[model samples]
Target: MKLTTCFSTVRTRMVSSQPKYELIQEVGRGSYGVVYEAVVKRTRARVAVKKIRCHSPENVELALREFWALSSIQSQHPNVIHLEECILQRDHLAQRMNHGSSSPLYLELVETSLKGEISFDPCCAYYLWFVTDFCDGGDMNAYLLSRKPSRKTNTSFMLQLGSALAFLHRNQIIHRDLKPDNILISQACTPAGSCEPTLKVADFGLSKVCSTSGLNPEEPASVNKCFLSTACGTDFYMAPEVWEGHYTAKADIFALGVIIWAMVERITFVDVETQKELLGSYVQQGSEIVPLGEALLENPKMELLIPARKKSMNSHMKQLIREMLSANPQERPDAFELELRLVRIACRELDWDT
Candidate 1:
């Protein structure tokens, strides 16, 4: 409880109805809504607030979906965004949190997004707001742009990211969108007395929570029948099975594979539009799309064996990544397995018996 706020009161408004927190600044805006940095009056706890409007039935439903997903995940997953509370009523004309149809969400405050730019886009013409903690360290993509990452640093990132995925999968939740922009970083003290950037998985707009106990993969995929088919997510990182409309939680692991490859080589994953077109062409011609592993190997700069390039890790790590990007979803390891492998890599790098 650091009782200090970020933005000043001259820019903030203290409303009587919601006396506990003060709206500080309009920090960000996206396709869905705008984000605000607010602070609690008594405890002075700073938080991010997603300001959304419920003008139409579609908007209201989207707001409900985001609120449900955010509120549900916060209870069990520490790596996920923490939702403070959902303020279900915000009169658009009046500009205060009164009993209305629109909802605004309160969340933990973090510093930056993976893009490193918090400049408000001013495109929130829709309804509903969602909130989450501010991640100070920025997203992994922005961080990578700032500097090349060492193997150990990237491994730490992979470990944390995998751990987060493990928690979500165990809870029967599937994060359909797992890209660099959705992954955030927070500053934390490591065992070596160093402040390090730890990964926090963000953005659950396209997430899926299985109605059935989502914990077991061995169970019939039709048990809950809810989490069976998901043809959603960024195309470049999407698995083939996902493209075919039959997949499980392993789809996320495929995205993680693309992320790991990018982390190792300091490369941006392929564009979504290109991925879609290529996959679409394959669909039109009834041809099987080639795996991304071939494309990665073909990249001259991403030669996993270039010893001169101290930026990337050894080939064994590349091999692990290949396993993650398997064409068949079943061949891909689960988050738990990936975490174990990352642990082994960490231990080996530290010279501990694994």
Candidate 2:
């Protein structure tokens, strides 16, 4: 349905409507929701607002998961997308609900997520509004592919992404879908055509929070130790274990490895669905180029060329990427160690900041 129908529906439902944000234009669209470039009425600050229609069970679950994952993070990281607020919208008969700890709407949503079904009336139209930081520089895929390959940009991105993943893991959040399309580039405060653009890891609809028991105050439970059975993610970015429906946070690292390696070598493939040339690694199987994870799952002993191309690449960086993409998850370094190793590699590179 068109977004105009959505606004009209809301207008008919509410008697005294006071919208907090003004929608400027439609930014993106997914299966469950539509994202709009909006501006806060009070502060005149730009924000991206995601309006999710909780019409189906799958849509509701995805919306709740995204909300839960984003809301669960108490501390903010520069490299991660920041959630400003969430507003639950119902019919005119019911009151609009602002997200809070004690909101019944939230409790209902949580129960729905756990039960995998909606408890309320199936005909009752409800919506979840997520207000977040607007990225003007667009997604990583677009930003990187539009520019010439540069060591400085690659090093900067590596450090930023490593730090972001470390922060998420420490917070017990695992971003199952980690790819260039999901990662946004924010050029806020930077001048036009500036070299430095802040990376913001976003789209946590498939993310999982790994917070179980068995943890000491001195040393908390590592995210890598938290095993999950959901085989959900882009085919190209999934780890070998993820293909088997059993994996941990290390899967995120493997996905990042694919992105890093592809970025360094400028390897690209056209997405059949979107017809967009996306940066990622793939294995040649006869005439078809299959995902690295699927290829590794079929043959665990297969070795990948770290550099993919006969170009200048740092030995340390190459080795680290290789380890990160190891078929065995145990051999891959955790997010914490990945950050440290990336820093060391960046420091060793003579033209890291060039």
Candidate 3:
């Protein structure tokens, strides 16, 4: 068959059995699957479809877990990426065919499309795909890199991020894999706009549902280990407890600290030399420290290379970041406390007249 004919036939066969969604383009790719931009034909709405590479049991379980978790917490908070529906692509259509009974899960996309932008639309016969409110501003990692940071810009982003994390914590969700790549900006806040971006936490692949009531101090370490000892998250963002075979909501706080540092310093923990130095400094100090910010302030090479300034982050922000980055997880503030502090700072900064 010709290329177009083959693609059409495949699309038809795939959509007939599965929920019909128009595949616009590939938006993201990870170890587990490829995420695509699709549209719901019926609603003319945009959605994100994560097609997992069905190879292992662990991958399958994680995919299903994410779906279940998102479904459970769909209405809990506005900042979370809502789970619209779960989809299963036919086993035959998948790259790896399933011989016995098996199924896949499709997640609802959460981004919106832009105006005056036209792409290939399926013929009327095909099923209408779903669309989310597109985030034209892209992921936070990309957003930070694109900016020429100053004290004001760095502080503003940090405060906004803290607010988002606080909201998540209020809902009792710990985003285990908290990093720049997973943070997305709403499409409504675009280039040359004065409006602040509606920051939503995307990719609940590694999230855990904690209790909003309070931490269960009596809960056994084994119980905690059962849920957290898997060593499942990104290496750079992993907290000390995670590395030592224990994890909790505080791990998320630690990650938030790493993220703030990355935004202000425009660096990641992936660099071998930098990671080694930072880890050494953190271990030696035996307490929370903002090594990246300090490094940026001290090194002339770094000062010329990155726009981050230590003076940019006000004392309140610095104190908050240090609390989150506390080496001892017990010393770190819970999401609730962090949110309260962030709100106070925001109110003061914006002069809300409250």
When 1 and 2 are scored with lDDT, the better candidate is 2
Best by TM-score: 2
- Indicate which candidate wins on lDDT: 2
Summarize candidate 2's per-residue lDDT along 1-354 as a digit string, tens digits. 122222221323232444567789998998878999988767888889898988777887888778878888998999999998666766533333333455665677767877888877776678887889999999999999999998888989999999999999999999999999999998856466555699999999999887665655556566888889989999999999999999999999999999999988889999999899999999987889999999999998999976777665777887898899999999999999999999988887746322
238-323 per-residue lDDT for model 3 (tens digits): 66677666667777777777777566555543335434222111221244443432332233133221113443545576667676
Estimate TM-scores for all models: 0.68, 0.90, 0.65
Count of clashes, each model: 17, 0, 26
Those runs of model 2 whose alpha carbons end farther than 4 Å from true positions after fitting are 1-16, 93-102, 190-195, 214-220, 351-354
Rank the models by lDDT, top first. Answer: 2, 1, 3
lDDT of 3 at 197: 56
The true-versus-predicted C-alpha distance at residue 329 of model 2, in Å, is 0.4
Order candidates by TM-score, high to low.
2, 1, 3
lDDT of 1 by residue, 233-259 (tens): 766567666777777788888788877
| Residue 160, model 3, lDDT | 67
Q: Give candidate 2's TM-score.
A: 0.90
Which parts of model 3 have CA positions greater than 4 angstroms off? 1-19, 74-76, 92-134, 150-156, 189-195, 210-227, 265-312, 349-354
